[model samples]
Target: MIETIVLDIGETITRDDRYWASWADWLSVPRHTLSALVGAVVARGLDNAEALRLMRPGIDVAAEYRAREAAGRGEYLDDSDLHEDVRPALAALRAAGARVVIAGNQTVRAGELLRGLGLPADLVVTSGEWGVAKPHPEFFQRVLEVAQAPARATVYVGDHPANDVFPARAAGLRVAHLRRGPWGHLWAGDPEVVAAADWCIDSLMELRTIVGG
Candidate 1:
C-alpha cells in the first residue's frame, strides 16, 4: 500500500486558474489568448512559460513578475483557488494514515501561500525553496525525505506527464497520472502516459481507494 502521497500543486490540488489569469492581466491580454498560447506550447511539449515568450518575444518573465509585485499585483492564492475536492480528499487521506505532502514546481511565495492555508499536509514546499524543480531526480529525492518513506512506498500524483509521471516513475516512486487539467486530459490517452502511470485517476477521491488507508 502507499504510505506517502505526494501531490503536485498546480491542477492536482489547485485549479491554476488564478495563476494564469494574473499573468494574462499583467501582460494586458485577454485571458483566453494567453490560455490558448499556453495550450499550444504544451501541445508542442514545451514548458508553459514559453507561452509568455511567444506573446512578447524577448520578454523577461521573472523581471515582469517582479515588476507586477512592485505594482501591487503578484502571485496570490487562497481557499477560492483550491479545487473543490482538494480539502476533503487530503483530509481523508490523512485520516487514513497516509503521509500527505504538497510539493511542486512553484515559486517560494507559492509555498508560503500554501503553507498559510494550513492544508492537511505533512509538508508544503516549492522548487524555489529547494532550488530544484520537477523532472529532476533531486526534487523527487527531496520529496522522499519529506515523506520519510521508501521511493516504492511513495506515490507522486500530478497532472503533467513530463514533470510528474515519467520522472517520478523513473525515480522509483509509484505515480498517479491525474486526468483533470489541460495537460491531464490532453495526454490522458497517450500510450506512453497510460503505460507509465501506476494508476490513472480522474478525481482525488479515487486515491482513497488506492491508498486503502
Candidate 2:
C-alpha cells in the first residue's frame, strides 16, 4: 500500500540540458567539459559548489544563479524542460489519491520554481530548506514526518542509486530507480544498485503499472 510517492526533481522530473548549456556558456567552457566536471565532482564525492569554485575561483556560484534569474535567463524549468511523462504521471497518482511529494537534493529556489511552474505536487522539500541533503538519514526522516505515513507505505522514485534508492531503502521506504538520467545511466550496470531497488523504470509511465494508479 504505497500511499505516498516521493520524486527526484533533476533528471527525474526536470530535464536541465538547456540549463547546463547556459551554465557552460557563462563559464566559457565547452558543454562536455562542464559535464565532465559534474561527473568528476560526483565521482570524488565533492559538493557541487566546491567543484564550481575550483573551476572559477572568486566567483559566487549562487550569486551567478541569482543574476541569471534576474536577467531572465536560466532561472527555472520551463514546460520544455520537464520530462514529457511527468505531468500525466503525477496527475494519475494524485487522481488515484496518492500523496505526491518532491524531495530532492536541490537548492532553496527549487521549491519556489516548482511551485511557480504549477507542477502537480502535494509538498515540495529541498536540501536547502531541510538543511541536509540526500544520502543523509535526517533528510529522509523530515520528509517522512511531512508525509506522516509509514515508511513501508511510501515509495521514493529517483535516478540516483546511492542518493535516492539506497538511503530511502535504509530509511525503510520502498525505492524505485528511474533510468535515463545522469546517475541512472552512470550506475545502470551496478548489480548492487539495480537489485536493491524495488522497481526500475525507463519512464514515469511505467509507474502506473507498478503502483496501479
Per-model CA lDDT versus the true structure: 0.93, 0.82
Measured by lDDT, the strongest candidate is 1
lDDT (Cα, tens digit) per residue for candidate 2, span 91-193: 8888888888988988887767777778888988789888999989998898788776899888899988778889998999988899876678777778988
Q: Would you list the clashing residue pairs of candidate 2?
A: none
Candidate 1's residue-wise lDDT over 113-135, tens digit each? 99999998889999999999999
Please state every model's RMSD to the true fold in angstroms.
Answer: 0.9, 2.4
For each of the candidates, give the backbone clash count.
0, 0
lDDT for model 1, please. 0.93
